[model samples]
Target: MTAVMAPSSSADDMPRPRLLERIGIPRALAWGFLGVLVFMVGDGVESGYLSPYLLEEGVSKERIALLFSVYGATASVAAWFSGALSDLWGPRRVMMLGLALWVVFQTVFLVFALPTVDFPLLLLGYGLRGFGYPLFAYGFLIWVTAVTPRRRLGSAVGWFWFAFTGGLPTLGSLLAGLAVPRAGAYATLWLALGLVVTGGAIALLLVREPTGRARLAPAGERPVATLLGSLAIIWRRPRVGTGALVRAINTTPQFGFLVFLPVFFTDTLGFALSEWLQLLSAMFATNIFFNLIFGVVGDRFGWQRTIAWFGGVGCAVTTLLLYYGTTAAGDNYALAMVLVSLFGATLAGYVPLSALLPSLAPDHKGQALSALNLGAGASTFLGPALVGLLLGPLGVRGVMWTFAVLYLASAVMTVFLRLPDSAATAAHPATDHPATGAPATDHPAA
Candidate 1:
């Protein structure tokens, strides 16, 4: 759940620039961004590095896929509860618990579990990984929203996600690769543990504990019922999956698919896994570089429209390519991977949506983002399951086509979405919303 801006004291009593113009962004955001590092380390060490290690250790591909699924499946349940718990006990406490769990998982992976362990037992232990994800993710989300001025909320949230997803698979890839190749998988676990412990320590020092009723009670924003209810209303509309919500879910498909992509390329495209990984890594490296580059573009242009346009166009081209490019003479492995990266990049939309939801539901940012997380988490799990099921029936071509259909649908729905009448949209045209300033008539004026 995204918690962009925690409710704060009125300007008359508070020391800051009325909350809106405050200046602690660097200090406050450092903690929030660190949250990304913690989560990514946990994910990277386990998902990024461990899967390959386990494969080397003799786990079957099907089992590995199930292992991956278990992580998301467990996280889906854990995060649902984390939302209510974060709302109740405060995200800080919940987050610390998650980090503590991370310590357990990393330590357990190294000292106790052996290659002789039964596959089922290993899966159960891997499922424990989910318990850590929600708490840290929520911590980062809330912390980012709490500190960022509304004006910069879009860029800030985008940057937050940039670190969270990009950290593990991209930046940390080198470390994981180096550790495993040099010292073995067990050593990699120890090193990842070190990075996370450092991050967790930072979390404790940097992030303030969310206090009793952080939301403004007098303004009627603090009610737990409102938080839950707003989410209920949004989901009931039948349109949320089409909105920024879909883009969030889309992040996982590209990622989850990549975990199995070697199997796809080798089995379907007739390349060795080594050759496929080389191609895949090159593509992923490109994807990671473009995230920073395009992120700047989003800041300069409108985050919302850029996300829509890029995702839509990217989805369209990728869909056509997947349908026929793999069939043609060139095949263009690099091009295919670039589109895959684009499929992933469109996810930058979540940032503006993160900031925008709070602007849309000024009183209920946490709830909205919680609902958003639920959809995203659900899609992450569903994507792999769908792939597993469909790959046998539809075959590899069918699976690619399915992604095409889903993304194209995403593009169509994007056109009709109305921005919640927000100060962000109204205050600036080119600076705020490049393509979708959406004429003054569509959304209610803030």
Candidate 2:
């Protein structure tokens, strides 16, 4: 007797009418984006003026530098583990651990360390707090890759960055600017803490994607193996390591630029501190929008080509123009603004790398992203370190040239980051199942 076959139901067959999905967000992970935005805003509250504030409080320059160095180091390690741990424990649990760490350490920092100006306690509290946001933010990033379809992954990762940068120095600094005058830095920190808690609760409670609740790696995989795999993938997939280096180079110059560009604009070029700051804000504000634009561009224009040309090569040219053009323009604030804005837009071109790296090792995406995260964390330190080391001997121009060279090198490296034929096909899969001629689902099983 012949039996009639029933139609199979899958995520692809389900109608996607949600506004978030229409705008390229994975429907299930929408709340997580808002959570990241708010959480990063809390974390970034101190970024704009923390060093200056510490100095005013009598913390020595040496101690402030040391504190940030330690914090950056811890952040790097945590960034690596965010993906690795996400593979082992699930993104939600990792994010929760990060939130707990941030709350515990930040309280100790503000209440005890700041009150007494105890350097050791301050270091202990703040350094450890570094582990919080990377885990909280990048953990969500791993969740994005896990649940998002290959076709829309670029756009999804783009949204992840939009929320991330939007909260960070952008809104966070704005919030700090408004609050510090009225509430003072200490109280402002408490406000930041509150935002963090609210954001964490929102994400953890509201987002109910099942994949985030379960291990990303295959069942029975040992924890030790999972972590070691994160390291091993660097060598096993040399392209992943190359991509990490490219990623590091992508932002290293931004941090380095911060070190000396302010002096160049304010002192050398005769722009006011506020004007320099406005320029900085304008740059990143332009970047924030392009992050979303390039994500869609990457998906449509080909990730490799988009990253290589728009991100790598574009940055190389724009980096040079920002320095030399600004120098030539002298007090041409309008011209300077245009140059800096171009640099910022080019910077967003690298957003596609987030989507591309994970595609390299689909079965081991967590490890792949761990490598990417390591580059990101390293940039926080490497850029400033480069400036600290080179500013005296090389001067600003030489340093700008150095950053331009790095961009060119990244462009060269990115040319080799092409996906395999099968992987490329998977990334842009056909709508119908070839064998059965049935509708296929791009969404992976949660």
Candidate No. with top TM-score: 2
lDDT of 2 at 258: 55
Error of 1 at 213 (Å): 11
| Residue runs of model 2 more than 4 Å from their true location after superposition | 1-13, 58-63, 258-274, 327-333, 432-446
Please, what is the whole-model Cα lDDT of each candidate in the order they appear?
A: 0.55, 0.80
Q: With candidate 1 superimposed using the best TM-score fit, by how many Å does residue 334's alpha carbon deviate from the native? A: 6.1
State the local distance difference test value for candidate 1: 0.55
Best by lDDT: 2
Compute each candidate's TM-score over C-alphas: 0.77, 0.88
Least accurate stretch of 10 residues (summed lDDT) in model 2? 1-10
Per residue, candidate 2 scores C-alpha lDDT tens digits across 1-446 of 00011111222245644666667787778889999999988987776667667877998655665677677777778889998898888889999999999999999999999999999999999989988888999999988777666566788899999988877766776677778878988899999999999999999999877778867777787899989989888888898998999998998898666556766787799986556656776777788899999999998898888888999899999999998998888978899889988998999999999988876776567888999998887787677677767777898898999999999899999877998866666676645342211225322111
